[model samples]
Target: MSNVVVQPTGITAADVLAVARGTAKVVLDPATVAAMATSRAIVDRIEAAGRPVYGVSTGFGALANTFVAPERRAELQHALIRSHAAGVGAPMPREVVRAMMLLRVRSLALGRSGVRPLLAEALVDLLNHDVTPWVPEHGSLGASGDLAPLAHCALVLLGEGWVLGPAGERVPAAEALRGAGLTPVALAAKEGLALINGTDGMLGMLLLAIHDAAHLFTMADVTAALAIEAMLGSERPFLPELHAIRPHPGQAVSAANIHRLLQHSAVMDSHRDDLAHAVQDAYSMRCAPQVAGAARDTLAFVEQVAARELVSVVDNPVVLPDGRVESTGNFHGAPLGFAADFLAIAAAEVGAIAERRVDRLLDVTRSRDLPAFLSPDAGVNSGLMIAQYTAAGIVAENRRLAAPASVDSLPTSGMQEDHVSMGWAATRKLRTVLDNLTSLLAVELLAAVRGLQLRAPLTPSPAGRAAVAALRDAAGEPGPDVFLAPVMEAAREVVRDPALRTAIEREVGTLG
Candidate 1:
């Protein structure tokens, strides 16, 4: 197994995905161990001196004023973990659970959490052994971190929770530990609090969403170019000088991709000087770059937020260099919540515009004289009429999912955490939006590919032809529509497959 070295300085988004996908092992650096030891000493000294540190000698949340006897400190920590492990709903996916575990390990390895190196090592062991805790879907308020979700993960380290066995069967954590040649370690003074106090759950989901969106956004550009050709839309709007004046980074890149994809197109050249067919195209065709470009810019902002979070130390009562433990609000999820919400809205717009293009490709009046619904026999075969309905349905759902989750706040912990980030919900909906966007783009691709075929001997540009040929291979030639669901699913797979992007890139270099 390839190793991802952990350090106090933290890791990247790609590294998080690698460990989550079970493609890499996690190892702590020697220097990181040394840094952890230095912070552990501070925690130990505070305990010895009987200081009422927030997560050490005193109780948590609203009970912080309550002090526990030193002899019962172990019980205090254990109770904290057991009580907080109250998540409800379906078990989270294996990759998401793995991602949460990996991110929590990174947070602890930063050394400010004051956890013993052994505690952090146990998390690494779970990741390397594929022993994932069965975390539930709900329970985070996104303030003071993703408490319940991380507590479920922390519970497994104490041999007191359920975990997915080697083959993904749910088993006792103790049994899983023994099967992996490992034993659960007891939590020390601040160890349990450290284990659960971070934004790992939402952050994990955000990183995974970013990874998937990168591919989806590129494919949107590809699908849009095909739709423009299918509709015989003018390529004049994508000219370099037109976008250069605006100077939005993503706009210029998107315009360049569309402009390059339409170059040398016999269809575009056939209508270049035809006054009859060459009035301004609809907004869906002419303004695709503007919409997609704005989404890309939003994604860039979300990436910046994720990058900052990856290196942060998000624990309460962090160990300071001067031998003091200070309580801080570093665990709040507001920053992540806002970013996730923004990205969700941006992605929904991308899908909305793509759906419009799909609708246009199916309408005879709008599709430049192509058969209605791209059907061989408009009335005999219902054709792709329902496919447009599917796209519209998905777009409606995307709009609902795009509502900002960051604006929501529910009080918890006896109203102690009165303003929560709702970031977990934000990231969750963002995933659904991206999923809908993929299907929405697939509908456009299916319609667009058929529209190109209807154009016949005019021939599309090299890049457009490459994309059309790839879709045709998966979905069959665009003739009479048969078994629409399977063909639509095939097109969805084509959108997801790297092969479509590979074919297009081969003809037009790399897309922006």
Candidate 2:
């Protein structure tokens, strides 16, 4: 966590995930109050000296050169929020909102956004108490720092918005603040612009994608192992010395992970001398590490970008060394915009391979000893046959969405805000890919576990049986063709349970 402090605002990736999942509290440092005071002081000095400052005296966006009268200063601040709360489409998930609020709070704590201590605290309170602003999901160029959605967030601070109470009632902002014993936050100096300008929303989404994809990465490795079990394919490819000669850290990690996954399986030992295993496995199964490892490397970089973003003040009019604020393009999200799309592609490929393995398991000829469609009574009970089809359909849809959103940009905001980073869409797409991939892997896990269970007397490798046991805890063995919805739900539940994941790790040891 301290590493996050020296690098960012001292908030780690683990912190955001905990907050996003509603399991932690948000507390800013006392020094953060001091930081806010300093930032606000710089703005006060500029105003007292009668020097023109951007966002303080000057207008915004197309109206930047126009000066605001002292009489309308408060009006201007409120107007900035009101005018920009034009977000459309679905409401953002509360977890994402909480993450955005915490992200913004940390950015302000860096002493750069010119917000006061209370205004920053209001954001922190929302995260802590779960009084999240009902920010709309759509309407962000991802350049100009996610204007519309963030404006809705700022509106809540100004005592104007729809807020969800802890009991799930939607209350008007004015009463909500009063009922919660919280005061309405007034934007002073650059606070209005700061509150509504930044990629916290996008950053929150990116952080979620990074975190969820990381868990899914481990899941994918396990899913591949299950596929190998079902296919009764070669395990020699995972030999440590083979990958040692030309080691990529990721390749070495994956080989070791898969090797341990199959370690004590009687099935693999049975195939030890088969020339067919040497002839090779399918590209999807054989090249699992190569394809999945690249995704892992991509994730390493994405994690750094997201962690840096927590402390980054991605808004206009940065406070410079001499207290002169020059409006820079820090708000433009090209860096993370491209990263979100790249991650989408990576996550999509994860689903792609997982679905193929699902296909391999379904094919009677390919899945030796396993009944076709994993059905004991094939024609009478449609056991898991359509489940593979569903997984395939979602995987194909993921491919279509994987087509980079960054590659297609449209001019907006009267051409002033042209070349939008559609980074919001990319972030959302990565989120979608994560959801699809998890559910797809769920199906593959179910089928593989079922296939391994069929060969009862012969125990699977130690790691394989442990992986199966983890599944058994969540879902008992399928006795016959039962309603698949429960099975799918159970599948998703296992993929999500942190305890089950730890159990698998303990049994299998270190994985890629």
Candidate 3:
């Protein structure tokens, strides 16, 4: 995976995603290895000189003032790993564990954490061989850098934890390492603290969430376009000139996307000259860009935070070039916590608005002349009536999950860590929000396409036609109500498919 020479500083979010989700390999720069050695030399010097460093010599957190004797130093590191590996919920997913491991390796590769190059290599080796450590879902206060979760990971490095087997079974870490032909690393001065002290877990989740949200947000725009045509709403509201006056970059991008999708629509043109239609549509259809655009802009902010975090060296008592090791509060997760919480709010609002559009598409009173709930026979079939309830239920859950986790902090580590960032919780709930949004958008896609299909002989635009046809190919043409769960799930799969985006782009050029 090395191109010419690999540098730790230029690693991308895509790189993180690759390592997290696929079989991508990591190649450390030789210079980075050399730099890590230099950093380790500083730690070695401090250990030899018998100086009382926070991580290298003295006890941790509330026990910071208690210094361990030389004989107990190694034991100090081991006990740290064992005691902190106290996470008690279900094990995290393999991908999340992989991402956390890769990110932790990236932090150490930066050479500021004073860990041996061998330790970083061991983590890389585990990643390349897929020896994912079993990390649990609970226990990170999001302070002191996702301590419990990282400790569970670090435990594998010491040959004392469990790893997920190839078939997703739990196996002993020692046995897994042996099967992979690797040895457990001995924790040295400052190494244990270095291993566990970073926001990699939460940061990894945030990065993955942002990646998914980008797709969902774009799909939201696509479904919104389909809904507008289905509702016989005017596309004039998405005019670039209208958005230019109140120029929000995300708004412009979303407006441009919807505008592109609505190009040459027979349904839109059918009503363009008709005096019988309402002058403007409801806010859900008219303000699609504003809501989704704000979410896009929020996602951009979260991306910025993730970008900065991807390269950050987040260990406390970090090594400096001039041979000074000083304690710093760099490990706090407040920034990521706030970013994740903000994104949750934005995602919830997007789902909320999309839910409204789905409801309008199903309501006889609101769907213009479309059949009630878009059923072929309104009274004989309940149609997508319950599907709207499903969307509404998800929206309600998202609203509750949207309550900011960052603002709900609690003290831990005996008040030594009095302030904490509930970042892990924020990122965890953000994942659920995105997942629910996917289903909500799927429901909208089903309703919108059904509405467009009923507009029948009138036909959707070229882009809208492509979206409708692509989904119909998967879920079948809408008609009398059949079992909708299977159809709804299929719609979600279509929404998730990259090919759906490709198909839409083939018809309407590239969307913003």
Q: What is the TM-score of each candidate against the true structure?
A: 0.98, 0.94, 0.98
Query: Which scores greater on TM-score, model 1 or model 2?
Result: 1
List, residue by residue over 1-512, the lDDT tens digit for candidate 1.
Answer: 68899987998898998998758989999988988999999999999998687889989999999998899898999999999999998788888899999999889888898879999899999999888898988999898989999999999999989987656667999988898888988989999999898899999999999988888988888889999988888889999999999989888888888888888888888888887985788999999899899888889999999999999989998998788899989999999999999999999999999999999899988788989999878887777899999999999999999999989898888988889999999998999999899899999988988888889888988877876777675667656668888888888888888898888788779988
| Per-residue accuracy of model 3 over 1-512 as CA lDDT, tens digit each | 42212265636788778888867888789888988899999999999999799988999999999998878888899899999999988888888898888888888888888988998889888888888999989999898989999999999999988998777778999999999999988888788999999899999999899999999999999999999889998888999999999989999999999988887888888888899999889999999999999999999999999999987888898999899998988889999999999999999999999999999999889888988989988898898999999999999999999999998889887899999999999999999999999999999988898898889888788867877777776556667678778888889998888888998888788887
The TM-score between candidate 3 and the true structure equals 0.98
Model 2 misplaced regions, further than 4 Å:
1-10, 166-169, 275-278, 473-479
TM-score of 2: 0.94
User: Each candidate: what lDDT?
Assistant: 0.89, 0.78, 0.89
State the weakest 10-residue window (summed lDDT) of model 1.
472-481
Q: List the RMSD of every prediction in angstroms.
A: 1.3, 2.5, 1.4
Q: Residue 238's C-alpha lDDT in candidate 3?
A: 95
Error of 2 at 154 (Å): 1.3
